[model samples]
Structure formats: structure tokens, C-alpha cells
Target: MNHEFSIESRQFNLWYGDFQALFDIDIGIRQGIITALIGPSGCGKTTLLRSVNRINERLGYVRTEGLMKVMQKNILDSDVELAQLRKQVGMVFQRPNPLPLSIRDNILFAHKLHTQSHEKLSRQDENNLVENVLRQVLLWDSVKERLHQKAIDLSLEEQQKLCIARLLPVKPSILLMDEPCSALDPKGTEAVEELLWELRGQYTILIVTHNMAQARRVSDESIFMLMGKLMEHAPTDQMFVTPACKETADYIEGRYG
Candidate 1:
């Protein structure tokens, strides 16, 4: 267990029924930095990301071996509570999936869920919380006047920003994003990338992105995976400019996935 690492995997292996998706994955994701997971389709980037919060177990058929740790605790332990674990780890899906509720309510949803039943915030405090998180995501000015409107009404970009905003009230130490800009246009992608830069150093962000340009633009560190194996992990510039592995070089040079 390394203090500098927010997430660490020790010989981690995962399987969907009989088919293994991850093979002896051993990596340490440093704390409070943005790391990008890159690979072609079916290379298990998402699987590895989902494993941090144990979302893979939702399928029931998913089984895992080896250790996956977040904040130095092994979440696979039976005593670990998913609800509390989720508080420390937040996820942004490939597509925006904001709750079908008001923007204000959406931001408050997770906070309320994690709050003790007896612990309650006054309406004013709630408003402050909403404003604070929305501002953090750089969305408050745009959505401030429409807090009561349904979140679904926002454009894809706003919806995605709101989705990211909602996760903040819980104060998650790690954010797992699976190609969060995949559903957005170029402008939207740029906006989200800027927001990610704003969020750097505040949280440990692990993003899975197929877009090579986006990976290079935003990540401090880059990880290259192939066939469910970690091929290379290096500084973003180093990996792009001078990849260590032959396979990594090949992949970056427009070779076969």
C-alpha cells in the first residue's frame, strides 16, 4: 500500500463468467493527478476503471481475483460497504446520465443519499452547496437561473457538466471517467477538457479515452493497454514521443490495435 497512490492493483484479475477481461493487472495510480487509459476496443480499459469502485459486480456474472485497493483499503473485503466506497470514488459514464430531476436536485441527490438521516442542511446551505459545486464545474453562471428546470433539458455538454457536478457534493477523492467527452461535439469536448484541467490536483482522475489527441492534451500520465494487459505506463509526453515497448510504439504509429 503506497501512500502516494490513490488506487493500486496487485495481480488483479477479473472475469465475466468464464471469460477473463483483466489479466494480472498490477499498477499504482498516483494521487491527485489525471491519468489516461488508452487502448483499442475490447482491451479492458473500462473494466479496469469499473473495478476500482466495484461496479463490475453489478452484473452478477462478474468474478474477480487479486487485490484492488482504494485509499489503502481492499474494497473486495466482504465488510466493505459499497455506499461508503462510492463516496470516495465517483464515476462519469461515456454518455451523460443526469437524473431526471431539477438541476439543483441533481446536485443535491448524492449529498442527501450520503448524509446521515438525522443530519440535515437548511435550504440556504443547500443552495450554497449547489452553487459551489456548479461553479467548480464552471456551470453555475449558465445554469444558475435555471436551477429548477429538469436536468434533461440541458444540451449534451451542459448535461455532462451537470453529471460531473453532481458527483462533487459527496467529496470523492477519485474520479473515474470513461470517455466522458465521447458523446459531445468538439466545442463540448474542449469545454470538458478545460474543466478536467481545472479539476486536476484536487482529485485523482482516471479517464478512459480512445481519442489520442484528448489523451495527450489532458493527461499528466498515460497508460497503454493491449489485449487485457498493461503494455506501457509513462508520462504522457514520453509515452507519445518515445514509447518503451515495441507494441506501444506500433500502436502510436498507426499500426494495428
Candidate 2:
């Protein structure tokens, strides 16, 4: 476990009931940079992403082999706490899914849940947190006056921004995003990409995206998967300009998904 990597998988395999979705996944996701997972639909990109936070295990029949580690600790151990794992590994889904609560409350929800009652923050501290996170996601000015409004009422872009904002108060070290921009329009996608750039070097970002252009533009490294197997992993530019494998080249060139 090199300190330079935030997440590592060794011989990782996963199955949903009798259907295997991932095979021999060995990866070392570098710290403090964005890594994009790209492949066609049903290639196990999302499955790999969800495994980072153990989200795939929600299905009772799902089973896994090998280790998935974060910060050098294997999270597959029976004693590992789901609550704590999720706190350190925040996830953003394909669509914005803000809680049906006030905007302020939504920002405060995770902080409040993770903090012990005796360690609760003062009202002023909570206010500062909400403001800081919103500003981090570039949403402060637009919704500053609407803190009490229901989060669901925000525009789709704002709602997605808020979803990302709400994760900050907990100080997550890794963010696992599954097609985070898929539901957004072009303008919204651009805004979110800007936010991703702003967030770079502060957290380890692993994003699953079908958009090759977006992956090339936003990620420092790119990972290509095919039929539940890792095909290539390299610097984004190198992978795009000179893929080492024919499968990788074919997928990038749009010859095949």
C-alpha cells in the first residue's frame, strides 16, 4: 500500500447472485487527483465504482472476493463499519438526489449524523460550514438567500451542485461519482466540470463516465474496462494519444464500445 494511492483493489471480483460483474480488478487509484473509469454500458465500470464504498452489497445475494482498500485499510473485514466507510468515501449518483429537506438542512445532515451529540457544532459553526461548502461548489451566491427553501425546488444544476456540496462538511478523502454529469444538460455539465477542477488536488476523485471527451478533459488518469476486465490504465493524454492495447484503442476511437 503506497501512501501515494487513496484506493487499491487486489484480485477483486464481485457477483450479484450467480452473475459475475467484475473480474480480477487490480488498481491503485492515486491520491489527490481525478481518475476516470470509462467503458460502454454493462462493462462493470459502475460496479467497480460502487464497490469502493460497498454500495453493491445492498443486494443480499451479492458476494465479493479479494480486497478493496481505502487509506491502506481493507474495508472488506467483517468488523469494518459501513457508516464510517461511507463518511470517508462520498458518492454522487447519475442524477442529483438531494434530500427532501431545506437547503441548509441538507448541508447539515451528514455533519449532524456523523458527529457525536456531545461534539455538536454551535449554530454559528453550522452556518459557517453551510456557507463554506456552498462556496466550494460555487453555489453560494445564487442560493444564499434561499437557505430555507426545499432543496428539491432548486434547478437541476443547482441541485446537483448541492449534492456535491453536502459531502464536504464530513471532509471525505475519496469521492466515487457514478456518471455524475449524465443527467445534466451541456451548460450544467460544464459548470460541474468546473467544480471538479476546483476540487482537484483536495480529494481523490474516481468518476465513472461514458463520455470519452469528458474523461479526457477532466481526469488526470484514465482507466478503460471491457467485459468486466480492466483493459488499460494510463495518463489521460497517453491513453488517448497512444493506447497500448488494441481494445483500448478501439473503444477510444469509437470503433466499438
Q: Compute each candidate's TM-score over C-alphas.
A: 0.99, 0.99
Model 2 TM-score (2 dp): 0.99
The C-alpha local distance difference test score for the whole of candidate 1 amounts to 0.95
Candidate 1 lDDT over residue span 1-257, tens digit each: 56999999999999999999999999899999999999988999999999999988899999999999999999999999999999999999999999999999999999999998778999999999999999999999999999999999999999999999999999999999999999999999999999999999999999999999999999999999998999899999999999999988888777876
Candidate 1: deviation at residue 14, Å?
0.4
Against the true structure, what is every candidate's RMSD? 0.7, 0.6
Quote model 1's TM-score.
0.99
lDDT score at residue 44, model 1, on the 0-100 scale = 95
- Model 2 worst lDDT run, 10 consecutive residues: 54-63
Residue pairs with backbone overlap in model 1: none
